[model samples]
Target: MSDTALGKDRRFPFGLTIATLIAFAILIGLGAWQIKRLAWKQDLLARIEVLKTAPAQPLATALANAQGRDLTWTRVSVDCAPAQPATLPLVYGIRDGDIVWRATALCRATVGGYGAVLLDLGVVKALTGQSAPAPVALAAPARAVGVLMAPRQLGGDREATVQKFAAERPAPYILMVETATPVPPGVTPAPLPAEISNRHLEYALTWFGLAVTLLFIYAAMLWRKMRS
Candidate 1:
């Protein structure tokens, strides 16, 4: 009820006590968030393990059976046998009204039947006056690993889109690879590139703990001042 109670808190004892409690709550929240992160990371690791161990299946079969589960964590690599050279209709990253570089790997099955992976190789920077990287020469049993991404129907000039042959480019049923590993004929496949963001859990704990800590400190001080 008095101006003294609402004044800018400058008293050493009170200020330090409040600040210390706030800092303690922050630290506690951080530690708890990290604990939750540990659980999430463990789950991701388990998913990766399953992808690697599960028997490789046809891309169609895999896509059809997926019951709304995140297919991005599900790694599938098909042995592609590209005969000569081909490109598939793909999404390109454009900047300043010019196509910067192709993000989608427009690829074709070399031999008869094999699945293609949308490889997310580093985008080609144009400032250096460079061109798109030459399509890698895929040898027999080419391997690729990434979560199976459902392809988008990018309806545009079928010819204007990136591809080696127009005949190969229909409404593409593409495989979206998260972190791609191209195991060309001779080389072996690499582990999935790990990328995990951890802000949600951090914020959750911070907000919840702040609410709790503020309530406690406010209650304690109210009781102290009243009793005094």
Candidate 2:
């Protein structure tokens, strides 16, 4: 009740503690989210590995089972007895550590989903500076074997751009050809990643470390305030 008693009474830093606690809670939540992401990434990589190495099956069979499942990088083969080819759009692709603009083509699948599928025929090599590579002649092959992939969405004017190359506007998918002989000359297949990145563990550790450091700072501040 006296002045000395009031001065001796220690008051909790309620505002500072609440703010620190909120920040700590957010950091912990982020770390937990990253952990969940880590598990998801691991599962995705495992599934991709299995699909890549699994025996090649009919394109129709793969397409049928692709519903509600990621069929990316799956090896598929089709007879494609009467394959028709048309150049899609010119896009830049990497080849042998060199950035080169490669021409992509579309092959109308007669057997599988009956949808037109895009094919990365090969790299366009220009001997003359600023000159474009000669277009590869399209040919119908007896059989086509490759990895099925989803089509990339164009940034602007999607419908017009897609329709220009893809007249049939087949299934929204493409196939990076692994082996389709007697179709085009001087065509090399584009490379795909063997494994996807899984960096969630590092991110989770960073968030957790931040939370721990915050806790230590908060504790030190409280101790100093109490002593004063």
Candidate 3:
């Protein structure tokens, strides 16, 4: 066959090749990122499991020991004076398969010199039709034992929430009250999550599988072009 006719029969798939290479790189990059995520998730899960059973420490001691480290899931105890009625922020949430509101308050910490701490009093079942329940008073001081959790952004209004519950300088972590003496009225403490899902490995495999499949398809296309 003449060179001109041969070229027409088997023109290089330049555009298709470029597109395929870009897609393959993206898939591979995604897979690598997922692998890194998998490692991080595994470490977090392990830390949570250990923290769940560790004996509770005084909140002041825990804070001192943390030294700027992540305090999430660490169990601690604190004594809290009753919070002001207006400072309570009812965060929307779900618990035990029911729509509920998480009752939170900023209270004076008798120990740790924390000045104040945000206490998650617990879940208040949403009224019929998922309406928010009426706010209630926190009238009793309590000795609370709970896990310290990072404050969740309430609809991106974390700054507003902080300002609403103003204190000398509030504790950075929220104390999710597990047990308290003279429990606050009309609110149940939310339970720790029963399980945290770890699916990064599966996601990594999926991305990698797509990249390999693309390579196979590209090779087949190249074979057909060469034969033609």
Candidate 4:
């Protein structure tokens, strides 16, 4: 054999091939994981849609029975006006800071007195100054539509959320307001950010494409060496 033949054929880089294969494996694994996540997310979305359309029951009823029970597929209603800005803080957020938000507090329906109240039924863009003072007469009664979420009752847990309004009720998270419309005293509606993050699907497809390319390249390299 010639001196050059005995020498390593740099073109057939075994170490480089091994490293590329490892990288390919990791990317392929990540792509597979993303696919699994997509399945899980779809199921969750379906569950939420079902909950949205379920029959609307009384908040008090749902609370009494649904509390500590399986509440995945239940719904309810609450009636109460947003507490005054002083008492029930109409909390709102600005680009810089947040102040009391406009509210359509839900009070449990009755002849008189307050009933399960969830405030802030109106929407307002914060102003430049210190949490611009809300309209003194912003009495928009919001007939908000939402899911009968488990009330967020305060407890001893350190990480638990504490409400600024009346003392903690059964479940601290009273309800997850799903829909809202403007009434006379409209409370500030909660901002609902989008749930779809499509980039993962794109990345997963990319990794799969790269893995396919690697397979072809490996085969082509082997064929060329055999031909030589």
Per-residue lDDT over 1-228 for candidate 1, one digit per residue giving the tens place of the 0 to 100 score: 456864534234576567767776776776677778768877867776787667556555555566555565555544444444334332344434555333344444432233333343333443222344444432222444445433333234323442443455322334433333342332222224334454656666666677677768876876665554
Best by lDDT: 3
Rank all candidate structures by their lDDT, best first, as comma-separated numbers.
3, 2, 4, 1
- Cα lDDT over the full model 4: 0.50
Clashes of each: 6, 0, 1, 40
Best of the two (1, 3) by lDDT: 3
Give the TM-score ranking, best first: 3, 2, 4, 1
Q: Please give, for residues 80-101, the per-residue lDDT of candidate 3 as tens digits.
A: 6655465465676645566677
Whole-model Cα lDDT of every candidate shown, in order: 0.47, 0.66, 0.76, 0.50
Worst 10 residues of 1 by lDDT: 183-192
TM-score of predicted model 2? 0.71
Model 4, range 69-143, lDDT digits (tens) per residue? 755334555654544333333433332244434333434343113234443344444522445554444432335
Q: Where does model 3 exceed 4 Å of error?
A: 1-5, 82-87, 110-113, 126-129, 139-141, 152-159
Question: Candidate 4 at residue 224, lDDT?
Answer: 72
